[model samples]
Structures are given as C-alpha cells and as structure tokens.
Target: MSAADGSASAADGSVNALTSALWERRPQTSVRIVDAHAHVGPYSLFFIPDAGSDGMVRVMDRCGVSHAVISSHLAIQLDAAAGNAATAEVVGRAPDRFTGYLTVNPWQDPARELGMWGSDHRFGGIKLHPDLHDYPLTGGRYAPVWEFAQRTGCPVLTHTYDGSPYNDLPMVDEVAARYPDVAILAGHAGATPNGFDAAIEVARRRPGVVLEVCGSFNSGSDIARMVREVGADRVVYGSDFPFIDLRMSLGRVIFSGLTEEDRAAVLGGTMTRLLQWRSGRE
Candidate 1:
C-alpha cells in the first residue's frame, strides 16, 4: 500500500490497524514518533547484545521511531565525560535520527561537565540519574545543571522512582518549584503501581514537569489512567531502549485505548514541544 493509504488507515482510530502495523513491523507514518528517553552503549549490569547506536537506529527504523533522544550507559554509570562523548558521537553520525542528552554526574564537577558539551547542538538536554549516582535530587550539587537548563531553556530528564531518598516524585516536585524555568521530564514516572498516583499528583501541580511513561511496571491501562488524570499533554513516551525492549514499550502506548489525539500527543507531540527550545538553538 502507498504511504498515504497507510496514513489514512492509522489515523482512523482503529486499534486493529495499529495492531496489524506493529505486528507486521511496518512504519506508521501517520504518527510522528520521537522517543523521549533512550540509551546507547553496553551496561556492565545487564547483557545487551545490541547496545550500540547502529543497533538502536535499526530497531528505531523497524518500529517507525522517527527520532530518539539518547544518553550513553557509560555516561550514566562510569565516566560522564566519556559517556557524553559517546552519546554525542552517535547523534553526530545520525543527526536526523537521533539527539542526545548530556548526562551530568553530580558527584563530579557538574559545571565543568556542562561547560564541555552544553553548547553542542547534538545534545538537546541534560539527563540525571540520581538513583544510580546515589545523590539526592534536591542536593546543592545539581545546581549547575538546573541553572544551565534554565538559561538554555532545555528540558531535564531525570531518573525517578517510588520511595527513594533521592529522585522521587516529591523530590522532583521540590526541584521543579525551585527551577521553574527548567522543563523536567520525570523519567519512569515513579515506576511501579504505588508510585503512579504520586507521579500524577506532582505533574498536576507542576506546570514545568511532564510525566514520561516507561518502565517494566506500567501497563497499557496504567498509561490510560495517567492520561485521564494529568491530561495527554502532560505525558510523553519513553523507551529505556537497550535496557528494556523498545517494541514492547511503544506497543503499550499504541494500544493504550487512548483517543487518537491523546495517543498522538503521548507518543510524540508533547516531547516535540518540549524539545523545541533546544532545537531552536541549532
């Protein structure tokens, strides 16, 4: 079938159309998709057979992901500078298919790290893994990142979960209030059943904060509930690719029983808006 015909079918709000497209590995051209959260490089903790950029882009093609924002596993776990460099390389190679998040290690000299790559157009935002780094989200060390984000009008994507001393929804809410200019993507949206409500409440209160849907715990129904609670504009889709299966994550959003408009926004519209400022800098 022609691309136009496919677009018509996908836009008809037929779940069967979407299901067939997914199962057949056909690109759904009708939907503009940008994966808000993703990763590259191998992780010591997990075995990822295809963790490099080439593998990532191949899957993105097969699944119809037009673009993906990535941070190298190295940046999040071992060496921030090296990891950021690796992420930059991937984005540089495929400027259209990818953009990168500059991973900042608060334990290290954050200011120095930001200074090195903050101006690079390949990097669209900053990524913080407070859970992995074991730093409290509200700690003073992350000040540089907030300040940089505010100045550049770039969004900050941070790892968040339930009941951790660091980077929970409440803690993210506190940071959002203090750095109101910085758009915050609450990664994982407080992963797990218990944290979902907390994530919704925080997004409801913080205009600058948006809930990113990803994680093993969230089901299609859970995604539908989040949209009902916070509104579709407040949620964005993320696939922790290389860590989790991207196809499964994308499938959840596609089949979540959301209306066509809501599903479109969650899949890409919201994230596209969130990244506009950074893209404008290019």
Candidate 2:
C-alpha cells in the first residue's frame, strides 16, 4: 500500500515527503491516530534492539502514531522511586512525543509520587502490575495509595488477565467505586479481549473507570463492542509496545467494523481528550 497523500496548498507548503511514505506501510485501513497505551522498557528488560527513547520516536514516526503514553517494566525490579524517575527522564526529553505513567511497587515503595509529581507535571498517573510485581490491589497496603490518588486527582493503571494470579479486576472495581473521584484504567482490557465484557460492564457502572484497549483487538467487532458499551470516550487505545506492533493494532481499529466516528475516537480523539484533561489540551 502506498502512503496516503494530502496536498498542501501554496500558502502552507507540503508536509514531509516521508510522512506520506510512512502512511502507505500502515494497514490498508488507516486513521489519523494517537496511541494511548505503550511501554518504553529498558533494553535488558524487554530486550528490544534499542527500545530506549529515540527508538520510541522512530517507531512512532514510521507507524504514523502522533503520540504515546510510555511506561517501563523495570518497575518489577527497581523501586518506584527509580522506576518512576527513569520513566520521567525519558518523557522529559520528548514532551511532544511522550506522556508517562508513574509506575509503583507497593511492596518496595508506596508510590507517593503518583500524586505529588503532578505539581511538576512529570507523570500522567500511576501504574500498577499486580502479578508481575506481586502487589495485591485488594489488600490493605494499597488503601493509602488510593487515598493519595483521590486527593491529588491522578488515575491508576492495573494489569489483569486469566493467567495472572492476582484477581485485581474486582479490587479495581472496589477502589474506583470507593474513591469515585480517582480514575482507573484497566490496562490491557483486563488482559483478555473475549473476557472483557465484565470489565466493560464495570466501566459502564462507574464513571471513573476506563477500559484501555490494547493487544486485544484480534477481531474488528471487539473494538466496535467496546465503543458501544463504553461510549468511545470511556475507552482508549494502546499498543503495549516492543510487545505488539503499534501500526498493526492501530490499523485494526482504523479498518475495524466500527462506524467512522467511533473508529476516529479509538484512534485518537478519546485519548487526546484524556490528555487534555490532565495537561489542558495538546
């Protein structure tokens, strides 16, 4: 597929020739896009050729992804202080290219920075991996963290799936309902595309919870149903990258069975609105 072309008028001048070239490599189905979920793991951790900062931008440029939210899996080993600092350091350089979620390991650190960092605007919210880091969201250790998030007005991202031991999906429900003010994004659509009905139901019942769609779109209707239940705005897009092909996943939605308006929201508008809520428009 050749890149899609848009002619620039004499007044504005043409866009980079490479921009159109990149678009053609994208799936037959294309949409102007912003990726809401993506991770920037260290080289040794995820073992991408050079998954460091610049590699991220390069992939974005090729895939026609305008922006991404980056997190690190190193949080599994490093304490939240170091993991979050690393995340912020990467985001700091490419403010235009990246937004980040502050990762927390409650076993090692309480993640006080989840909210406090908002003063500096370094992180968009807090990220937690229950099975990977072995912290139980339903346990008492997480109460204060949820309280702090409520006080500071940041969200929490939680990992869920059938293989994982921690059953935090129910716990996520409890917290989001208890702390109605604090927002929570169910990372990876509860980790099972087909198993997502319950999670979407939770988001439907609770306004603060959002279902983050990533790596789950094996079928086009998966995205269409997400929009139907969550109403587009409450749903967001992500690639979980260096793990999934950002371009392929975005193309899945762009070519999805959804209506054009709904597809547009999944591609970028909903995510753009979420960022706008945090930093006041991009």
lDDT of each: 0.90, 0.68
What tens digits encode model 1's per-residue C-alpha lDDT throughout 31-99? 889999999999998699999888888888888889999999999999999999999999999999988
Highest-scoring model, lDDT: 1
The Cα error of candidate 2 at residue 110, in Å, is 1.5
The ten-residue window of minimal lDDT in model 2 covers 10-19
Q: What TM-score does candidate 1 get on C-alpha atoms?
A: 0.93
Instruction: Write candidate 2's Cα lDDT for 1-282 as tens digits.
Output: 223332223212222222344455642224557677777766344457656778878878766777787776565456667767778888898888888887767686464655545555657766777777676667677776687678666667777664455744676777777888877888777767545876787788889887777765355577778788888877777777756767667656655656556766777887776655566522
lDDT of model 2, residue 104: 68
Q: How far is candidate 1 from the true structure (C-alpha RMSD, Å)?
A: 3.9
lDDT of 1 at 83: 95
Looking at model 1, which ten-residue stretch has the lowest summed lDDT? Answer: 10-19
Report how far residue 96 has shifted in candidate 2, in Å. Answer: 0.4
